[model samples]
Target: MTQTKRRWRVSPATIAPVLIISWAVTSAIATGFNFRPLVLLELQTQALFFRLRGEVAPPPELVILAIDDDSLTRGRDAKELKELASIRSWPWRRTAYAEAIDKIMAAGARSVAVDVLWDLPSERPADDQRLQQTLKRYAGRVTLAAIHATSESIGGGLDQLVYPDPMFQVDPKAIGLINYSPEPDGQLRRFASVYLNQIDADLRQSKSDLLSFDEASLQTSKLPFNAPKGDYIFFYGGSNTFAIVPFWTVLYPQNWERLKQEQIFKDKIVLIGPTAAFLQDIHPTPFGDLSGIEVHANAIATLLEDRAIAEVMPDPAWRGFYLFLALAGIGLAIGQVSKRTTPRFVLAIVIAGGWWLVGYASFVYGGLILPVAAPFLAISLSGLFYLSTGAANDQLEKLRLRRTLERYVAKPIVKEILSQPEDFQALLQGRKLNAAVLFCDIRGFTTLSYKLPPETLVSLLNTYLNAMVEAVAAASGTIDKFIGDAVMAEFGSPVSYGEETDAMNAIRAALGMRQALAALRSQWQQEGKTLLYHGIGISYGEVIAGNIGSLRRLEYTVIGDTVNVASRVEGLTKSFWTDILITDALYQRVQEHVEVVFVGEHLLRGREDSPSRLYSLIGLKGEAPTLYHQVHEELRRYLGYIEATES
Candidate 1:
């Protein structure tokens, strides 16, 4: 195919590598960029395989309403709040808390837990009166926030949050504490399981000894925790308990809540925190940013239902390892497919896919926090490298072969030689080769050519010469060259191995040539075309053969006196009045292996210094066979006769 044709479509030569390259590049990207995207993918993967083999947290049951722009409308008019001097500076409107608390009292929810700070006493007398009235109406029904204790002893709890009102009219029996002293990390790593500290303080102040006095009322606290190991108790309800309802919802009558008689303030755990804008009581965590109330909810839900991400909190060393593995694994996977463009890209595919599979399996199933980066990139890049490199090398080999062979051989022959690279270089070698060398010349070319038109002579010569050269190569002989109508060939040089049967091969080849020309010669006679004629001499001898001439202009040929005599013998073919003739030396070489019929002895036409025996090669006998079996048998009889005569 031509280059233009190949350009228009994907060929076998190009399609394969292209596919492999695409795979590798994609694999490289997947493996290279390891960050939030990869983690999201991992989470999705976890969702696929994360089975609740142990206990599962109850599903989140609460809905959310962000204390967002919508909540501003319920509190106070933005314009009015800005105009009011004292409130413009204070974050919340004086009456806002009362309005929200009143809404909660009307909602009829099981319990209302206020995630607010009431550490300082009420400021506005009117606002305080309104709040106190609401508090009395919902007495013992609402759980209020305590100002967290910011004890310079580094202690901070519900005390610092909400200060106790002197007119605290809510029923003491219904009151509950909403306080959490959590970690700086914003994770509620530990907490007191029960309100024992409060029980202690409440007793110190009231001397009621509530822990013992509350035996009948103990069911109301309903602390579900059971461990006795530390002053702090760990209570994790199922994931269901961890639901984070929006703080803004507490102001909506439909979405708010009031304590039911059965709540732990009735029969449930109540958590509280600030979600109001000015409060900004939130921090970041692995689960994303969350409110302290939500964190408390998460802690309770964790203890109740025990759901968690299985973290293999690494030793310092493994932390580095985990990071490296994750990034490296992804880079390698993408690199693998990017490197190859072949249909057989299974290696890269299998390997990269395996890395991902392995990472997923270890993290999800095996519960091992492994490094996912390096292995993934290794497989991907390696595949890409292997394929791209392979294609480049293959193209190079073809070009080299094409350039090297074109210098000496014909295109078709060069193609044949290249078709078998294994044997091409070995085609030329120096060896003692016994071959039937054919040298043919026009019988009277000089006179005949003068008689015909130049064009006519040339055409005739081409016809005859073309016919001879075809015959030589067709018979497994190498065409050395064509000298006008005189053609030279070697049957066992550049190609040998049948030299033992050289004499027979030469005879059959010569006969084939003579027979092949009968029709052509007859047709030429009928057309008033000149009859073609030539002399062919075959000889067998050890000859030196290989390519000869300067490096720039070399020819494949055989040379020696054996070749000279072959030419000299051709000069005698016409003199002997035969179309074919060979030296006695060729016949002798095949002495016991073939049969030859003598055509009689003759003096060479060009150099008649000595006469030589000439013969025609006949076929061999299959049984009791030896080369020239008949001649050797006759010679044996003659040798006995000579022995008797000598005696």
Candidate 2:
């Protein structure tokens, strides 16, 4: 025989699923590439980012010098002058500041930037000249500190004390206006960088008369010391200025001799700022409390090491393109893979989790922010779209299954089947779950229907069917199907479990159904309705449980010889004068668990040679022994006869 090749036929519905999946997952893949959150975090973290990024800043050359409390106190103790009232008459006196100043000069220091301001004439004029004399001697090397603000009101003090020296002239080589004015919070976030030097350095050039500049002759001849690199670390509240040199260090004999000789004043740059009471110049910085000189030291370090703690974000035009491209790509990936219905949800969860990991890693290690909000948005939107379609198709499959179950089983049974979605799917895939099945039918439905109008017969049948289904449901037995007027049920079907399980549950559900039917039958008789008795048959065995049909159609039902045998056993209820008949296999399992009367053997369908013994399940526990024993003896005798005959 020649084999025929199968061709796939596509319909609008068929292609619709594929298209939807493509569109959905594509949105997810596109959203991930936009790294925007880098800007959202705190600035300190941003500072850390640059620190870790290793971007270098150009070095700046500057230093600080401060006049402190010891000078003032020593002058006072010597009775040099009587406070601010007698400015000119104050007698001069030398203190620790003068001694340290001499040592710093001997240290090969480059430039001394004095950040101290002489707001007023010192209480001791003689003592003040000694300090000014020290500044004047190194006038070429010293950069005098002055208060440069919109208010130049507090003047003359520095000019008179330092600038008015008769022994030496104020060197034009000195830099002027050294204070780094900060914002009210004193946060040195931005470099004082570019603007202030125009005013301050301009003033210094004009006053100092220092020149390397060509007037109108040679087009260019500017001085070498002109360019000021703005890179400087701001140490707000520590000893960057005064060197603290501790009052105690100066008092030490070894250091005192060096201080007197001005040995600390070599080529090193010296910074001086407050580190004592009365002269408060402290502020908080990264490494803790610092003073102005310490700030200068930090600034010097930053410049030297080429360190910048901030990043200027890329322009909007590029940012927009990046975001758009990332989102678009993610969307494409999501849409492409979404066609696999069942796995789509699993894939979405995996995508979301994986994206988080990547984003976190990028942020922590690479100092780069991944576009999480957008990418996640795309994934979620795409996943939701894919999910909706999947759910719709799933529901459609469910409806098909319910229709099939309805044909064979009752409403309650159909509802029970629907309750567990996984179980229902397993049924479609053919899983033998632990479930209880009940098979029921009218006692003389065939004969009774023959005598009555067909319409009236169906009505009566529907009533009994309704009652029996309710009885099985009440006992937790799932009605598998109804063949003509006969019903089939089982102990376990939908859920598969260990061996001893389905047997006991099946017996319980069967016993409960018997009780339920008994009451229903009695009520029907009392009402004068077309009275009918029902026979129930139950079996416990592995069977394929699932939706049975093509893609266009499907039905959830159980199939196997166990289910067939249960039906055959139910059919034999007529041969024996009994309302309920169960096989020996079922009886052996539930014997010790429920109250059942073993009926004598009967020829079960599909088993002509061997007669199967039947049982009437009454209820649970030790309720009715006499009835049970009688039925048991009859079953024993009949089964013995069959066994002997078979041998």
Candidate 3:
């Protein structure tokens, strides 16, 4: 009976649920456990988005009056300007701020916010009076900086609220806290319009609010503030994003004329603070380290322009968005109708790229923030799962094939076939190649069956065929088929070790079968059971070898003249009164390794015209003499007697 080949295929429907479940479980774990890595990855991706957006133009209404390094150096070095000489070094007199504010207000500025904190009265009483009077003059127009300090006592909290001195407190609403909230990574990305002093029982209980400096500045300017309660600031750019006019320049007569001519401060909210590195007010941002004044200006600009970035994922309604994204990406990667890995990988990459594009576009155009790292990780994990499953399935299929192939061929041949699976698959379709075919048949099976009962006859046949198969397998020969008491095998068809080697292996297998049968006969004789003898024929030639028959029922065997000749030679063994026979073609290949005697040339059973040369295989050249050597002597004497009789 012909055997059919089975194929294994992976269904996408079966894999889809696994991928979905894996994604859901992973997302749940990440969300429930609050995976910090994913959060940090999200922040980094957001920073990347900022970098990709590059520098944006800040609002023209906002300007920074910076106390930079240049102004500080000139204040001490420019001895010609005796009025500015007193402004040298750290903590310049409050009189300079008083004068700068006067000049800025005189220039038709909308508002002036001093980022410096004058928490203590100046040593010069007259200078404090002068700064205090100036602040009161522009009472509601000026916003002074304050701080929320954490108490060193147990349970550190915002227990201390440092405000400008009482003398400088012109408008109560003009004092706002300058405290910035940095994320876990020490990067400043968020701003709050108003902070509730939760640490102070009275303030928390009374529901009084503490405003940020940016909020106070906007309120003092009388500009519309439309920012959310707390949101991520849409930074205009990195450092120097806003226009900067040095403090000394604003206060000097020569520079004041230049500034007034250009209308630098006109209708603009001027933020006065230290921009020099020595002042130590720098903080890390998405773009880079920026001075505190620039951060405040960016925050104020965000509120004034209503460009706060709102996170959509934090909303409960949108929580499923990540799951959907992960599924879509995984599906694009592995849920394909075709099971090719390259296309799936390419599709996965496209999905990731497209997601990044959408995220960036949404951030740039819609002022919204979408998740980046978590979804990407989900997609990557899903792809890895798919690939690992595919690899495992492939291994299982190979094992199945190997087991199936081993049924027909020996373990060594099966290993060869599996090592180059594609090539072996092609060979199974059919190929014409040189190989050695062997056929072995019990000599007197028919007579033995007549003398014995049906059960004994079947048992004896099975025992004989098993020994023959073991011999073939030991020599790396493929067992083609078993026809009753006869066995057909081939060497070097599916996998070859060269023509000479195939011929030698076939010879070796035939000799091994002879020895196995000899032992069986001796055992049967001692047990007083029927003894059996067999003849083997080996032929080497080109033959068509492959799986033949209908698709549903196939047989992997060799066909053509080489197989036919081998069968004919096995039949000729009875005529010669010998056990083993080989064709001239096979003898030629294995002549050096095997000893053989020429048999008379004769036509095969099918062909009557052309006669073929045949030989009786004796023993291997290097091995000790065996039963075949005795058989060789008997065969020679018989041939001589037959020749004499015929003559």
Relative to the true structure, candidate 2 reaches a TM of 0.51
lDDT of 3 by residue, 33-108 (tens): 5567656777888888999999999889999999999899888887788678658756898889989899889989
Candidate-wise lDDT, in order = 0.52, 0.51, 0.80
Whole-structure CA lDDT of model 1:
0.52
Per-residue lDDT of 495 in model 2: 41
Q: After superposition, how far is residue 198 of candidate 2 from its true place, in Å?
A: 13
Q: What is the lDDT of residue 550 in candidate 2?
A: 86
Better of 1 and 2 by TM-score: 2
Writing each residue's lDDT as its tens digit, candidate 1 over 1-647 gives 65643336443434434544454444335434544455454444433333322223443422222344345444444344322222223455435556655544444333344555554556567777776777677665445544334435545343332335656535653333444444334333333233435434643355232221111112223434333222221222322235444434554334444322222122333343455545676644334455555545554443443333343433424544444444344334444444333522457657667867876676544545444443455455545554565455445544554564344223555556556634233445455667778887766676677788999999988888767755664565666777767877766655454666545556556655665565567788799997766678888887787657875566667888678888888876654445567778777766675555687777765447877788654444443333234333433454445355556
| TM-score, predicted candidate 3 vs. hidden true structure | 0.66
Q: How many residue pairs clash (N, CA or C atoms closer than 3 angstroms) in each of the candidate models, in the order given? A: 98, 94, 0
My TM-score estimates for the predictions, one after another, are 0.37, 0.51, 0.66
Worst 10-residue lDDT window, candidate 3: 192-201
Model 1 residue 331 CA deviation (Å) reads 12
